[model samples]
Target: MSLVVPAAALGLVAGAGTRWLLVRLPRGAPVPVGWCEAGLAACWAAVALAVQAGRLDPRWAALLAALSWLAVAGSATDLLVRRLPNALTVPALGLVLVALVPAGSGAVQRGLAGAVLLGGAYLVVHLVSPHAMGGGDVKLAAPVGAAAAGAGWALLPVVAVGAAVASAAVALVAVVAGRAGWGSRLPHGPVLLGVALAVVAVAVPGPRIPG
Candidate 1:
């Protein structure tokens, strides 16, 4: 509970900064302040609680926070422009790889492998069904995968499966509601980000599995 206050404060700042950047970027659209505040506050508080619960160390918490920030920005951008700019995804991927350096040689190796595997998988999907998956989503997958790998190797498949299932469910609902058709493009960044965070939160407390 003590962590909540500071976490909320930091969340407010992070949310506002994210929204500010979103507005300034090309094809950027404004999101409701309340929604942004609540979403970011929740994400920040989740990290704080994970640290308090000993599920994650300060370094991992910092990395998650950074990735969450990028996810927030990427999600909003993707929603508006149907594109995830390299500006966000590329820097996020670089940051995750660099941040994992001090986590240990094993972690670095796992993170890199996770990035390659997930990124490559997405690339293949994109190549096969360019209309179904966006290039931006392909880029976003690397960092999300790296974060999952940093959490645990087993988490990579878990996150991937979870995201796929969730995205499919959402798409199915959209089709049922007539909001989208079978071939419609959905914004995938948000789903990937959400799954990554959830998987990290759950897996970080477990014994580290070798990648």
Candidate 2:
């Protein structure tokens, strides 16, 4: 397919580039260059390919996807450092806004709403048990909203349901592997991005429902 070329190529290139950045960047934890790049790139490219196939507008899909990658990277930082660095998060979002002029900035407002919702959810959880949620999650919620909002109304619910399902699956994985325990923190950012991407994939192209 016409889209497959860029999808696969971008996946490889982005993966390699991310690996380079991860290795060269001064950081707290030791992570493999190949592993992180390959993994993240694969996810990005896969989302792109699905979008292309679904016959959605390519530019809109690409724009949201780029934001999604930023979200993924930000979330990865939370997983690695156990903190959301404004140094990284703010700049990434600022760049997103700049690129968004052509794309239109309306989604940014929606993203803010998404962020507020997520922050509120985490806040409630924190009130119930501070240890159950983290401030980093609030930082993580903004872009998920942006991505879904960029896609339009249908995506919000899709993103919510998808993220919840992904989170539960991850929890199940952790529990089955004995990685789950009381007070153990789960990385919600990754799951949020996963839901956004899943919606992207499904919204683009899939089996049609019988009328």
Candidate 3:
């Protein structure tokens, strides 16, 4: 088989396996909403590989992929535990930075800047309106920032546009289903994941998740 296709498939397996491992954590989240975790890893990994091969800028693709997983892993954590834990977010923060070395210097900058922006925003939100956000979410910023910052300034728009669009879509879906009300509580993590992936698609359009 061709290298890209098989690698893509492996990504899917890895994503799903990550989910299974997530289940073993203390969180109470149930089965995933969909194959999102799998999609996130497998899909982005393929892109990362392609970019590394010079099909795209290795740095940008890695940044996109890392951010994409932050959204994915965070969302999944919240879904399972209703809270994002340092157990996951902390290591993930380190992981994101480590993942950038090969992407290039631009990626390294993006990783740093994005992490700062995301963490700072989470902190402000937590201190002022803790209900609107979680401390764990703040911890998630390191990785998110690392990934986005590494990708380039263009990713900033991807994140912003993706977040807005995904939020509206989810709200629209809830309203159509009649489950969410004017003040109903929703899982922001999943919304964030959706937005991140959307940004990736915009940045690096390609096949569906690996499997």
lDDT of 1 by residue, 1-211 (tens): 5786799789988788777776676766667675566677878888888677666666566667766776677776777667787767887887887766656677778888999999999999999999878898999999988887876788899988999999999899999999999988789888888888777765555324332
lDDT of 3 by residue, 1-211 (tens): 3456655666666677667766676754344735554666466656756655656554455545555666666776676667776666778767777777765665566677887886787688779977666677667655665565555567765665566577677777898899787655566666665665555546544332221
Candidate with maximal TM-score: 1
Error of 1 at 157 (Å): 1.6
In model 2, what lDDT does residue 194 have? 65
lDDT of 2 by residue, 103-175 (tens): 4556556555655665466567767876655665655555555556554556777777777778878888898
| Candidates sorted by lDDT, best first | 1, 3, 2
List candidate 1 stretches off by more than 4 Å. 53-55, 206-211
Which RMSD values do the candidates have, in order? 2.6, 4.6, 5.2
User: Could you tell me the lDDT of residue 139 within candidate 1?
Assistant: 91
- Tell me which residue pairs clash in candidate 1: none
What TM-score goes with each of the models?
0.86, 0.70, 0.74
Candidate 2 residue runs with Cα over 4 Å from true position: 1-3, 19-29, 47-54, 71-84, 95-108, 204-211
Which candidate number would show the highest lDDT if scored against the true structure?
A: 1
Q: What is the number of residue pairs that collide in model 3?
A: 8
lDDT of 1 at 117: 93
